[model samples]
Target: MNYRSSELLEKAKYYCNELSKHHILSKYWYELALVLKGSTARGNSDQYSDIDLVFFCDKNILDRIVKDYYDEGLISREDGIFLPLPEWIGHYNLESYDDLIGYFKEKNYPQIWEYTNIIILHDELNRFSGIVEEYNNYVFQDMITDIKEKYLSLQLTLDWLRHPLKRGDELSVILHCSKIIRLICQLSYLIDEKTYPHDKWLFYYLKQTEFGNRNENKIKELGKNIINNSIPLQVDKELDEYSQYVLAESIITDLKNQIQLKYGNEPWLDEWYSFV
Candidate 1:
């Protein structure tokens, strides 16, 4: 049950070798590709961690391989479809390397991390590695810009929702508090120059970083309280008769100031204040 990265890589290799035993797969062995993703690739894997792999091949070939395994009882139908390949990919056609890159780029940060952190088991032309290199070298200015915009927009929404929250609208209170927690987590990752994973993995990813480690327990508690429709003690103490939304706003502002102090001002900061 303990899933080490080396063991996971070996398992992937074994699967590739098994697939290669088939005449059709053997003929296209070089074209068959495997990538180790998720917690294992990040080196934060645990006993319960799921092994996520990305298999790149023609759709028909993938289908045949999966079906063969299923028919032979080597893998359960669910295991053949879901464990090796997630159910989400069923909706998309990802046969080409270009298509894979496009999917990775367009998907959320976790998926991008998966693409960037892959260990290609077999790539004849070395296409997969080249694509990963391109992504790694690409400028992140646009991504930063997008995050800044989202932060500002959420701030504005929180500002607008403050009145309803104070008016004792339960839904507004929950939504407002939730947005603050999310904004802070996103800003923390952005300031650290790390890609923020999806929301479910946000705190887990945060715990793995130095920045998050300092406030890991605090953030975890705050996140739980937010989900349970309660305000964290720290936020309540800082409220000072102001609504919870204001506390959230001030936290984000303080974070912005800290980032500015550490990294100095950029055009984005100027633009952010211009809107404020």
Candidate 2:
């Protein structure tokens, strides 16, 4: 690992240790911390940026433990149910390795690995590894195959929106643009080991990825125009259609190349978007 990764690992280790002190999670359940999205690849993980954590436990025992902690005042509740552990804590969830991976696969949950540093507790390491292996063999392999198809379908969507007839309607453009952003965001996590940020940081982190570049500027311009227009035009005739086309094409091409490189072409590639 480079210096930044090494530092990140250490910080993650420190966090695990602190959680252990609180009896929230210990080194035994600590699996590994993963880097998701952002400039972490650029070595820019700082205090303002939160590090996401996935705390795995035996499904049967996990809920009991969390409940016990809350009852004892060792933890506090947010939103009446969600436990707010500490300031630095980003995402916290409990799942047995088996069910958790299944949920991940089913939901197309991105960033479960990215910027995630898991600390598997000692006794459960074997269980954790076994589940991961099973997922790799079954769920993950299928997921890789799905990634390519989704990318191809995504490209088709962008291609359709690029047609002259479809290009002029601002509402239509916004709809297609939103779909493209979502596809790229989801696909980025699927391939590059990325994750969508928590709701609080979603837009900011989106702007930090390739998907952001494709849609953020236009979304911002449209947003401002909408706010300023007393009666918003059904379509913004003033918007730069040519620039939008170029941006959309670049994003589609980048996504296609990334999909091919990460997941070889699969015959079922286009079918994957049915889930979308």
lDDT of each: 0.59, 0.52
Error of 2 at 78 (Å): 11
Off by over 4 Å in 2: 1-15, 21-44, 73-93, 104-112, 115-124, 140-156, 159-172, 184-241, 246-276
lDDT for model 2? 0.52
* Tens digit of per-residue lDDT, candidate 1, span 177-252: 7776776776677667666777778766776555466566655554454433464223223234544544565555
Reference-based lDDT, residue 85, model 1: 28
**Lowest lDDT block of 10, candidate 2:** 32-41
TM-scores for all candidates: the values are 0.70, 0.53
Give candidate 2's TM-score: 0.53
